[model samples]
Target: MTNAEPPAPRTVVPIEPSLLIAEAFNQAQVTALRHSVTSCSHAAGLTGQRLDDFVLAVNELITNAVRHGGGQGRLRLWRRPGELICEVADHGQGISVRRLSERARPAPDTAGGWGLWLARELSDTMAVETGEAGTIVRITAALAAQPVTRPADS
Candidate 1:
């Protein structure tokens, strides 16, 4: 048999969900964007503390994009069954490995470095994809509280 070339590596792309809001933003638009996200998230069934936490998490992502990811970015918001999702993408240098790996609370004395950490803490789940070209952060919050299940004592 003739020598065969190795197969190309597969790239896994997440399927696009139906979008509720999609917009481009810059420093001047941060406030308006946050308001829009808040409205959309509320309409998607999040309420009270969950709504507030989700809005705060999204704000952090947007602010980070402005401050660290080149002053402008794109945002997308959507819903999937029981969860609401928001994604922010910016074209700037990628995040360092050290920053990505550190998930602890920042020291109270620290002046900055709270955005990503706060986003992670506030959302039900958070994911980031970054490289020299840009960075994308996606955060999800549940629309309703999930029940906690306990195992039977044997």
Candidate 2:
């Protein structure tokens, strides 16, 4: 047998907006999730601006799931170490980003292409996993006691 490395320890974090249920596609569910995240972050000492960023990224991911993932999905939000993480899962057709982008890149006239792109850009880290069970898009943003600063500040 060959030598194998042990798995790294998982990061433990506070779970606030845990396992949100989206029974049907609607504007209210999206709004509720956004508010829930921002409120949780703010209560945990995360500032308004930083909360806004988290909300934006989370909304984009969630919206994409509801709109593209057959009009329904599930979401989970938690704080991991120094970051806030949001995971949205859908039980519909999975996305193939490679083929979709290569076939016809969403242009200015496109409707929903910008959501995922914006989510990835706003969050510190973004990843997507799709399988027969569902598609889950994970987004993370660094939280700070104060508002986030631009890199140019240094």
Candidate 3:
């Protein structure tokens, strides 16, 4: 068999930087919303494990918005260059500072508090904005694998 060099990575150019999916969802719509996010994210060039991870992260955010926020929330998904971004917002009283500051994984016996942790762990980056009016959680995952650099030997 002849040896072949790997093909160079290609950059993805989004057709429209506008939102791919924007919807208001409640508990009943969570499953459907997840499917839509999967389709849009795959179309935006995220695939395989990366795509799965991003979808899961989005699901967690949505669930949290429903369960803790105010029983309803809004979701926005889009892409920017090499990354896919998703934001979930809810109109509840807002998350407390103590809850927002805890980054440690929950204990095995814990009954709740896994959503935000999972979202943060699965995405490339995550941010939260909260106040008396509402809370918004934004997360992003790279659409392409970043190249790993190695130091030259002395």
User: Relative to the true structure, how large is the alpha-carbon lDDT of every model?
Assistant: 0.94, 0.71, 0.93
Q: What is the clash count for each candidate, in the order shown?
A: 0, 0, 0
Greater-lDDT candidate between 1 and 3: 1
Write model 2 residue lDDT over 1-154, tens digit each, in one string: 8788889899886454443333343445888777876777676556766667767887887788877786777777676556777778888678776733543435987765777777777788888888666688888878664566778845
Cα lDDT of model 3 by residue, 1-154, tens digit? 8789889899997666858998999999999999999999999888999899999999999999999889999999987878999999999899889988999999989999999999999999999999999999999988775577999899
Candidates sorted on TM-score, descending = 1, 3, 2
Q: Count steric clashes of candidate 2.
A: 0
Query: Please, what's the RMSD in Å of model 2?
Result: 9.9
Worst 10 residues of 1 by lDDT: 12-21
Candidate 1, residue 27: Cα displacement in angstroms equals: 0.5
Q: What lDDT score goes with residue 29 in model 3? A: 99
Clashing pairs in 3: none
Q: Model 1, 75: alpha-carbon shift in Å?
A: 0.3
